[model samples]
Target: MSLLLSPFDMAGTPLTNRVVMAPMTRARALDDIPDDHTVLYYRQRASAGLIISEGIPISREGCGYLFNPGLYSDEQALAWRRVTDEVHAKCGRIFAQLWHVGRMSHVSIQPGQAAPVSSVAVVAERSNAYAWVEPGKAGPVQASTPRALSIDEIQRISGDFVSAARRAMDAGFDGIELHGANGYLFEQFINGALNTRDDRYGGSIANRQRFLLDTLDALAATIGAEKVAVRISPFGRLFDMQPYGDEAETWISLAAALSARNLAYVHLSDQLTIGAEAIPQGFASQFRKAFRGTLMAAGGFNRTTAETALAEGELDLIAFGRPFIANPDLVERMRHDWPLAEGDRATFYGVNGAVTRGYTDYPAYQADASL
Candidate 1:
């Protein structure tokens, strides 16, 4: 049997297989709350060993796009509970991906139409935020210039994450994965070139990594460390993240730091599939050596590559993003060597007059009756 199809234990969580459904933003939550459509969508893809949900904004201020489901309210938590119940009924495990987009946001989508806040007062050049273009209109607009977060505000945001994590547990999530990658809030502070602040949250490598580590510690204190995971993109240039000195050392040091925390896992988000530079060669092994725990990576992986990585001990689990969109029975399809279906790009996001059109309309693979 291929290792990719074998069962594995993630911390104490038992998985039916080693294939994880990587989080992808579908943007179907028109009201910033999970609805029946959200339940159906996840239920259809429950075959994945574990499902990491789409980036759910921790608060309105953390949101970068319109129509994203959030976890900062009781009503939203209640709605997500329904989705989690259904997925659990199918014997599937799901993790809530807590997200904060930081400056990757427009004032139009921000609360009170205020400027987005980040580690510093810089704008992401050539980056776009999915927000309002005009009254009652929505589209991609240039990300707004952000104000630097004060010390008090930074602490407040960390508290917001802890609050969201508690809500995630109430929503019946098996665990919570912090969105620390892709030049988001965490990366905005981690990147030395961008975060030039002369405070405890910036400057030296230790200081730069303080925010994420401190927040992770707080989350672990609130929820068991075994129930917490994080996703990061090393050397990622998404949203105009500039490569900085000590980039390699920064990531490796973080891996070593996280190793001591005894968390669930460290997910590496490779940017190759998203049209950004790929993670440097041999870096996964370097990270694997440092982290010493269940390590997962997602980007341009198929069954063959996944199995190869697992066989070589480079990755304990493989995460599939776009493939899971059209192939709800992705694990079974891979197990039986069935051909996969492609998703429609046009209907990947937004309601488009039919919420289920591209969201839950993908049929499971059926063997030919003639056979």
Candidate 2:
């Protein structure tokens, strides 16, 4: 059996193990630049086989949260360089997760308080975005409806991704991962219910996928194909995403298309949200057969299940999100079968320096910690 501790190679990079720290939104950056605190937070989790950084906005219009980082500015890229250097100092490999939130955003967080942009003019349900709480405070606010993007604007957004990829390379990241899931910008394009455009960006799967694929091709052309990866959620219904009858077929087609790119990997996020339906069994195996490259699966996976999947050749890597938030040495704990600590939910998305509370304060495994 291939234990979770087994070493693996992600494209050209050699991982110390198969454990990956999944990308998570930590509203810590100021003016979209990673501050000194953000560097310390990632440095604490550097023991992971791979660390996928939190979602980074590609441009001012792409931002959805008050303190989330962006890569368009030179100072922002330089700030991220500090984080990459710190993580590398511990011999850790990291990837930047490029993001655009689309309709799941509020005007308060958008550029000049403009309407959030997406494939269609739609409102997200059961969603919230981080916003300013007071003069200097930040908190969650209900998401606002978004305006549809023009064809020219969509092209501009796609081009912005290429620029972000270059900025990520300049920031000293090992690679970059495109965030295509969770009813964000890409899902707004991929999901038929949300993308009701009459032009080439909607109607058919190929058309709906054009925007994402174009961005992918552009980024891959700017940065090497092997250095790019993408994450997708096939059955996810978060942020008011409605499931299409042909959802599985749509994703299968995407997986097949991705196989031709020779990209680093494709991460599959399960529908694990509250009230969300579970994905059908055998979905991972089907995707693996079509993709023909490194495959990663996240959501509700533990050591025993991850080992079984690896042993059975179902997944090449396993990404843990919440576990890594509270356990910086999650790999070491999993290795020793140590009991994990529960994270404080209130501190998960805090602001005003409280972001550092639940972030870097988590202790590594100690012999005295009750198992």
Candidate 3:
């Protein structure tokens, strides 16, 4: 049997298979709260070995997009409990992808119309935030310039992440995955070229990575390290991230740092499918050598490629994103060599007057009678 179809233990969390459902944001949470639609959406894809949920903001200040369900408040936690309960009932393990969008945000979505905060005062040119273009209407707009975060504010934001982690545990999640990838808040700090601060949080390579490491350690202390996972995108040029002198050194050093922590896993996000440069060849193996832990990666992987990757020993687990959108029983289909269905791009983000049309309405694969 292929390793992709086999069961494995990720830290203390046991997964039924090596197939993970990658986090993808579907703007169905109209009120920034998970509702019945959210419950149904997750429940349909409960067959995945692990489901990393779409980014759930730690606080309103951390939000980059409209309609994303958050994990800051107790009220939001209660709403998430419903989704977790349904997924757990189907014997699936889930992790909330806690997020903070930093400069990739607009004042329209900011609290009190405040500017978004990041490691430095800069604007992510050519980036857009899904926010209100006008009153009562939400669409993609150019990201607003952000103010630099004060040291006190940085500490406060770390506290917010810890608070959200506690809420995720209380809501019955199997674990929490820090959304440190794709030029988000964590990446905004880690990228030395972008985070040119004069304080302890910038300058040296160690300083640039200090924010992420510190926050992860705090989360591990609050919850068990075995239940915490983090995702990173190395050489990721998304959201105006540019190449730096120590680009390679930065990521490899982080892999080593994470290795010592004994966390659940280290997930690598390859942005190839999303129209960005892929993680260069041989880098994954280099990372694997540095980080001696369960490793997972998501990009574009079909059944053949996924199986080959597992066979080659580069990735312990393979995460499928868009495939799971149209095929709820993705594991079953792959195992049986069944044909997969394609998803509609237009209906991928928001509900255009039809709430569940593209969200929960995708049907499972049906067998051909003449086959």
Every model's Cα RMSD, please? 0.8, 2.0, 0.8
How accurate locally, in lDDT, is each candidate? 0.94, 0.88, 0.93
User: Estimated TM-score per prediction?
Assistant: 0.99, 0.95, 0.99
Compose the digit string of candidate 1's lDDT tens values, residues 164-228.
Answer: 99999999999999999999999999999999999999999999999999999999999999999
Model 1: clashing residue pairs?
none
- Tens-place lDDT per residue, model 2, 171-191, is 999999999987799999999
In candidate 3, what are the lDDT values of residues 1-371, reduced to their tens digit? 87899999999799999999999999889999999999999999998999999999999999989999999999999999999999999999999999999999999999999999998989998999999999999899999999999999998999999999999999999999999999999899999899999999998889999888899999999999998999999999999988899999999999999999999998999999998999989898999999999999999999889999999988999999999998988999988999999999999997788889888999988888898
Residue 199 alpha-carbon offset, candidate 1, angstroms: 0.6
From the highest lDDT down, the ranking of the candidates is 1, 3, 2
- In model 2, pairs of residues that clash are 133-137
User: RMSD, model 1, all Cα superposed?
Assistant: 0.8
Give me candidate 3's TM-score against the actual structure: 0.99
